[model samples]
Target: MSWTDERIEQLRSMWEKGLTASQIADELGGVSRNAVIGKAHRLGLKSRPSPVKATDAKLAKPAKSPAAPKPAAAPPRAAVPAAPRPAAPPPKPEPRPAVAAPPTPDGAAPVPKPDAPRIVSIGPGGFIRQGPGDQQAPIPPAPPRRLVPAKPSPEIADKTSLLDLNDRICRWPMGHPGEPDFHFCGEAVNPGFPYCVEHCGRAYQAQLPRGTRRPPPPPPFGGPRVR
Candidate 1:
């Protein structure tokens, strides 16, 4: 709305009286708070404190009164002595019969008690073996261990030459073909295998049933020990 002289004067007076822009807008009909503010700014009326800040200051809680000093603590009460407990009676000793020793001939000595049976450790895990007598019988020398001879490998001369190779014969190569000594295993092949019984044994190994396979032998003593 256009600001007439009358409305402008009213706005200046209201603004100077500490009225908010909204209040001035309501007082001057046909004008918005922004319009009133713009007119007041143009008129160069003295700027007033912000109504929001003034309301906040007025609404703010007053400083709390200093807390009252706490009262002094009461003195501790005296403890009363408890009545003494009666002492328990002492236990009576039990009666036991005296044992008498057997009589012996005047010059004879007393016989000694038999020795306790002794245990002999034979192996690991505290294995104990009782012998017929007080002492353990000597462990018989371990039966002499004999090494079983390994099956001799097929001789190179026994291997079949390329010219002699046949479908029924083992096709397992014995040696490098580039060498003059190269030959094929000439043994009879298993029905479905490409190699003979021995060659097949070396070629395709069957997995042993679980828990049936033997553990690898321990390394010999005096060698590097595995931690």
Candidate 2:
């Protein structure tokens, strides 16, 4: 619907007066709520918070009326004065026992012992302890670990094995042979490699860049050669 100058002014005024898009749309003839919203947005209108919805309790309550003023209460009676009481004398304080000081030669004062190393309380539920001198040479760092290459499993070479061997299963030894959990990778072999894509990458890490083009292997003697 076309927005005339009069309709646009009315829309701006109603929007400024806190009317919702639906209400503005209803007020403006031949306009939808979405249309009003779009026009308002294009006009860079500031958005107001949605008016609070009226609850059933509020809607059900009747409007309160002003009540008639009540007559002022009679003046309160004057209180009778109480008689003054005689003040009693304060009791004397008892004498405290004398402490015996350690006797030193020539009236020299006794020296206090050195305090033990303290654990100081820091921020919420935290504590800081005074460390012993040198603290055991700051714990020498561990040696750098070596990445040993995965060895081929001897079980893959044996033809009498019960485990069903496939051309796809990765034959690399996974962990230490002495460990109970030691196993071989059984993932599908990558094209032109004995290992899977992952193990092939690991096996040829220093040799080649990944995804490099390679010539296909020659076909078997009895099979037809592929171009």
Candidate 3:
């Protein structure tokens, strides 16, 4: 693009001011970025003097000389009295009665219960491996053992609460869910003594008794044929 006279004048000043071609190109804009340098060379603009047109665009750069000392600044213009530093604004009045904050809360917000847990598949068979914090918790001291409730005995208090069946103590709270596969369908709870509503009902009939398994019946009491 052809350079405008004004642009050429600015270019001269920029060059005299020791600006690099890149700087001049930025100011001029639009022309091939290299146009500034080409035009200056074609027009015989001498940055220093002995320099011939640069052979390689890459090496066309000339080393910068120390900047010319700036002219002494003109004496500071007579001060016109800066509007009298606007009267130091009056200090903000102190609060009359500062609000007393409610006594700091006894403790900060309660710690949130951890999220249920995200199931992650890791093993080759896609077996789930829990993320960390697995053992951190000390198996919440299994809640106070609730007694397994017996069948809905007539004596049961609320038919709902197992303690009603028989004050029989349970290692675990009664009525709780039991192993999925073994839970019984017969009675919602075992009938005899106190039985775990969860475990007793479904226990193998022979093992129905609450405590340890009973000794085998004395070998089916042999026939007393000794008349």
The Cα local distance difference test for each model comes to 0.78, 0.74, 0.61
Q: Write the per-residue lDDT of candidate 2 for residues 68-142, one digit (tens) a residue.
A: 899999999999999999998899898755555667898888664334555554665575544564246667889
In TM-score terms, candidate 3 sits at 0.21
Model number with the top TM-score: 1
Candidate 1 pairs with clashing backbones: none
Predictions: Cα RMSD each: 25.1, 31.8, 28.4
Q: What is the lDDT of candidate 2?
A: 0.74
Model 2, TM vs. native: 0.23
Considering only N, C-alpha and C atoms within 3 Å, which residue pairs clash in candidate 3? 146-172, 146-173, 147-170
Q: Write the per-residue lDDT of candidate 3 for residues 86-133, one digit (tens) a residue.
A: 667879887655444444478655544444556665877877676675
Alpha-carbon TM-score of each model against the true structure: 0.30, 0.23, 0.21
Off by over 4 Å in 2: 52-227
The lDDT of model 3 is 0.61
Worst 10 residues of 2 by lDDT: 156-165
Cα deviation at 213, candidate 2, in Å, is 76
For candidate 2, the per-residue lDDT at 168 reads 66
Q: What RMSD does model 1 have?
A: 25.1
